[model samples]
Target: MLQVISLVLENKPGALMRVTGVLSQRGYNIESLTVARTLDPEVSRMTIVVDVDATLRQQVVKQMNKLINVLQASDLTESPAVVRELVLVRVRTAQESRTAVLKEAEIFGGRVVDSSTEGFAIEVTGAPEKLNEFIDVMGSYGEIDVTRSGALAIALDARKLKLQPPVPTKAGVKMEETAI
Candidate 1:
């Protein structure tokens, strides 16, 4: 199973390295990771995706918390969340296949984010399975290149989950659905 672990660490050198090193030392392969600053300048948040069995994952989470730099770590796979991944794809399309490509893109909720004489660059965001289906369907059209962003997850709750010094949320972003 893939566990998406979120971390909040101080903005300093070697902090991220320590966390990654702990996982690497344990031979856990990271499938994806996304790190960014919250509203605060002193802290940064990270979402890490790794595939590990439940029992060992608990151990890993314990070890992660032990790290001085790690403020929070959780197995979001156990939470009710909506997961999304962004894909930027460039496809080789001829004049004859242009319409077909556009149609497929629309069917997949993708848009032509970029275009050139060579081809088009499509942008799509969806669940992992849906993204896989979109990528698979694009293969028949022509040569394709793709890049994906790591998964980010937010838990839904009345209480603010702290991975570091807590950050506040404004109005409108609710707790009903946690986006992963």
Candidate 2:
């Protein structure tokens, strides 16, 4: 089964490498991975998609939490979340196919970001399946180049994964454990 795992990590060099290395060492395949800085510049969020069994998914989450740079990790497979991927496609356009291609692109909520006598560059953002369908339709028109941003997702409502700092005890010492 495919699972979406989200992680919040400290924004620092080699943080991504550590996370990916752990997964690679365990022989897990990453279907998609997207990372971007969060509103807080000190932190970054990563959304990773991997195909694995439920037990293995839990193991991956646990391993992620063991990393010092990883502040929070959560499996969003069954959670209420919003996910999307962006795709930019430049398609060859002939006088006979230009109108048809534009109409089809409009049906998928794609915009003509650029156009020339040779082709039109269409930008589309939506669920992965929608983008795949659009690509199939545009294939007949000829694709010159294509670039895609892997899936990015965030949980809905108050149900989200977050990092909390350890509380101080009566002894005046802060705990080292990370709060999920």
The worst-scoring run of ten residues by lDDT in candidate 2 lies at: 171-180
lDDT of 1 by residue, 1-180 (tens): 788787777777898898888789978899998888888887888888898777898888888888887777766778766567889989997889998999999999998989988789999998877888898888788899989887877765432556446566753356534542
TM-scores for all candidates? 0.84, 0.87
Looking at model 1, report the run of 10 residues with the lowest lDDT sum.
Answer: 171-180
Pairs of colliding residues, candidate 1: none
Evaluated against the true structure, the overall lDDT of model 1 is 0.82
Off by over 4 Å in 1: 158-180
Best candidate, TM-score-wise?
Answer: 2
Error of 1 at 63 (Å): 1.2
lDDT of each: 0.82, 0.88
Off by over 4 Å in 2: 160-180
Error of 2 at 106 (Å): 0.5
